[model samples]
Target: MLYWWSKFVLLGPLLRLLCRPTIEGVDRIPESGGAILASNHLAVVDSFFLPLLVPRRITFLAKREYFTEPGAIGWAKKQFFTGVGQVPVDRSGGSAAQAAMSTAVRLLREEKLLGIYPEGTRSPDGRLYKGKTGVARMALEAEVPVIPVAMIGTDKVNPIGSRMWRPHHVHIKVGEPLDFSRYEGMAGDRFIERSMTDEIMYSLMELSGQTYVDLYAASVKEKAAAAEREAARSDARDAARVPGTRAG
Candidate 1:
């Protein structure tokens, strides 16, 4: 099939040769059955590299945009992502989030390994951020264990705004599966969801050795962009106040 061909015949072999990723504690991943691989998102390649290295096929709930890009490059990207089993998720409306949760639970029921980034977005500053409780809810509903995975050096391999990938050696560390069976049938409890998500984040913090921020990564990125825009506006105002300076 396309997945095997891409893994063994096409992209997977090339990436392994190029990046030379190092993996640790891969045995922690369950040999069979449904489970959640909860990882810290670092770079865009974090999704690509983990699936390439792990023995089991991973299906990440990726954004719909990745699959909807236009032109030849977009077509190729769509092929690669689909070939590797990444599912498209729409994150626009309130119903979208609920729909994604439903999709994840269905995948688990079908006994597929699902990959989720509890933080909801890539770390803007290399520090782990507070996780969205959706992951905890899915785990509770699915009755599956959550395995914590830390991807190191991927940020360097393909850092923000870099089109070219460098041959940096990446490391993957897998921790034991976290069991939340004690909270079974408590899916709608906000307090239990928060406690479970916090515990999972703590495990990732220990595994990745990144500073833990209590704020969400997406919020941090937004604030940073807003600050940058404000600074630019302030500079423009200062320039306009200067005598003989044009606002162009």
Candidate 2:
């Protein structure tokens, strides 16, 4: 209810005016049916933008943090998410992620469009990382077609740490529906599962124009964090060398 209300009532007019998204193959998305809208996670705004752009009421798996925020901000965040028809998914990995996948399958069975990010998280360095097999497993088990939608230039509008939105245009490209009919009932095999996931990622790579990374997002994030710390320490040391600057 809230999803439609917000999309058509609240912010629809302004969002449309600001972002005149040029869509290609909009007809590719079925008018009414169950399928997976798998896309590369590029920005936090991807959730809002993609859902709004698509004609269907696409359901995205949102992070648990949005539901766990504090104070008035928390209340508003909850309302906004609920309005957009987002499902709460704990992204911490392990058991929580597994449970989320299970719920996703249930939604698929109901013949609804389920949006998932095969790459797990937003590309840290604007590069498409390896996709997790979870997406493949879901599609095979649910027997649904996967549509690879790529969102580019959104990271610039709302990058990782920047708290302001820049007046830059964002582009979204929707690829043809990728059929996995040959792999029907093959989710049980780990090898086939990985291969299917890779095929989806390759389509997304062409759509989003992001460099492909062989490593996982979590590992790369850890290394990036460590590098930032080292750089910070080096900067502090250099500052201390100046006259009158406090030093250890």
Candidate 2 C-alpha lDDT tens digits along 1-248? 88998787876765566665555666888888789999898788787778778899888878889888999999898888889878888878799978888888888888899988888888898899999998888898889999999987778877998887655577788999999999887877999989988999999998877889888887889899999999989989988999898645
Point out where model 2 deviates above 4 Å.
233-248
Model 1 ranges with Cα > 4 A deviation: none
Cα lDDT of model 1 by residue, 137-231, tens digit: 99999999999999999999888888998898999999989999999889999999999999999999999999999998999999999999999
Model 1, C-alpha of 107: deviation from truth (Å): 0.6
Best by TM-score: 1
TM-scores of the models, in the order given:
0.96, 0.90
Clashes counted in candidate 2 amount to 0
Measured over all alpha carbons after superposition, the RMSD of each candidate to the real structure, in angstroms, is 1.3, 2.3
Among the numbered candidates, top lDDT falls to 1
lDDT of each candidate versus the true structure: 0.92, 0.85
